[model samples]
Target: MALQLIPLPPALWTSLPGRSSVRTVADVIGSTQPWRPISLTPDLTLNTLLSLLPPAAILVGIASIAREDRMRLLSVILVGGGVSVVIGLVQITSRDLYFFRITNPGYPVGVFANRNHQAALVACMLPMLGVFAGLRQGARAGAKLQAAFAAVAAIALLPFVLANGSRAGLGLAIAGLAAGLILYAGHQGAWSSLTRSRAWRLSAGAAALAGVVLVGAAALYSRNDAITRISSATTAEDQRFQFIPQMTHMTADFFPVGSGFGSFDSVFRSYEPSEALLRTYFNHAHNDALELAIEAGAFGFIVLTVLLGWWATRAAHYWRDMSRDSSARRFGRLGSVVIGILFVASLVDYPLRTPLLGCIFFVAACWMHLEPTGRTQKTD
Candidate 1:
């Protein structure tokens, strides 16, 4: 899908609005490269291609593995998320602890360059932790131990997610937690027993209350900025919403065929509204859907709609009559839910643009397509 435009004529590539004097001498020299006319900006288009490889590798590589190995790989992803949460927490205290140079300095970015990306990744992992604990009881050592660890980890991680300060992240985290609980109960075949027992009901209430209190305490004790940011009024009307009209105009200018992939930053400048201009620039459309519309044009929209329809059809099939025996289907359900979360997050921010989150998104899709092998599969 990404390679579809490579064979198109160079003259078809959208031209830049004008050269900015602010561009450095190197920028001017680099603009004259032989491949410059290939796309709106062939350099950025190449970077986009490079950015896509890791996620593609993850999707294909994992699908080729045995079912048991795939389950183990999912467990590793759960562990990696936990480690990222811990790193994010440490980063809150020590500004120098981040792995990326361009990350949200003095903020909880974890292994990502953006806190929202980290938040979205952590949020997606929350439900997977519960799902894995519930369904991953193969003939392995310490299966019970694994379940217990997942439960404790989920509880401990909840407070951090609440304190992460992303509105989208916080909302998704709560929703994922609820979905995880439902998936867990359904898998354990304990829904009837859980509902009949008043103790279980009371325990759940208490846990919920404790979580709220913990989030409050964490914010108050640390004098954290999370609460403030979360409660603060957003300027979406001034920026994101305002860009919509101009973005639509830009998309219409290119109509059926887009300016080209990775062309938004260059093409958008031509259509940027005077009211929207400021000291900063929009490297992305912020809304991945709209950006795809601008860069890939109407064809992108049609492709996305078809893909969405396919996802919905598969989800309906996998989600119908879920049972403990149907572990592959259950795993697929989890993947479907995670994909939904990433899709929602993309509406307001470019979570899927980042490599880590992008890889997670594709890996989750791969999980959705998995089928039971009945121990007949070959090892990768």
Candidate 2:
């Protein structure tokens, strides 16, 4: 679907009001496109194609994997937090990395351009690791190993997620945990192993470790910008909320049709209100729904609607399965809920825009679909 739709936005843009068929730098290949004018030139068409390929590639790679290899795939996911923790430690202390905080050097950003994005990845990783620890209790040794892995990941990653100072990240982390608890504990006694004495002891130790790490992180990054941002977020000064109604009007002005593909930053200039006339250049709509609608017009909105609908169906089916099944299948089903967290996060910021995140999103979707739906078939 992405392979098809990603390239079409430019053509649709050319057909919009005041659009043209101008040629661009990226139009080096075959030029069968509709929205030829305005900003939807063959160049953006090429950009779209390039943008969607990585996700498609990830899907193809994931499809080649077998369902019984859940341990391997899941272990990789858990290890992501560990790797991030190491990188984040370096970025915070050395004040290096491309997205390193110059304004406030004490924050952990890892490989991401923004701390919130880092926090989002960490937030999503925790519950998944926890879920693995809960579900991988089929054997005694594996259970012990998984438990230790979960504890270490939590101790290493949770403080960064919590104290990294992303308001949305913190909220999403809590929400993700709630979603995981719901899906994971749906079946009676499904998480009995997680409630054992060893689990309690590990949790205690992880909690103490996380506390120490969190305090150290805060000390290192002495500024509390997150609190101020939250306050502003509640007020009218928040850029995200400010972008909403303006974007809504912009979408309406363009009507059922929108400005053009990749035209948001270019087009936002005309709609920029007097108050929004700041030095900070407004690039994204800050809201994916609004950005999609404004750029792709009604077509983008339609795509979002269909995706949400399909997501709902998958989630419903997965929820039903989680209610009765305690197999790896149910664990795969957790992807649906994790995506739900991603969706909610999407409303506030474009997590899916990041290439790595986009790949993760598709991989999870593919994993969810591969899992067998019935109680009889345990694996995909």
TM-score: which candidate is best? 1
Clashing pairs in 1: none
How many backbone collisions does model 2 have?
6
> What TM-score quantifies how close candidate 2 is to the native fold?
0.77
**Model 1 RMSD in angstroms:** 6.3
Report the lDDT tens digits of candidate 2 across residue range 52-92.
88988877787787765643666676666568668888866
> How many residue pairs clash per model?
0, 6
Compared with the true structure, what per-residue lDDT tens digits does model 1 show for residues 1-380? 35533644323332332223322343667763222342456667778878898998987888788876766667788878878888888988776688876667877778877777887887788779878776545446676777788788877766676557676677677667766776665566544344335535644664475446545655655543556665675667447677888888877766666666787888788788787688878778878888888777777899889978978987876665443235676678888889988988898789988887888888788778876444321111
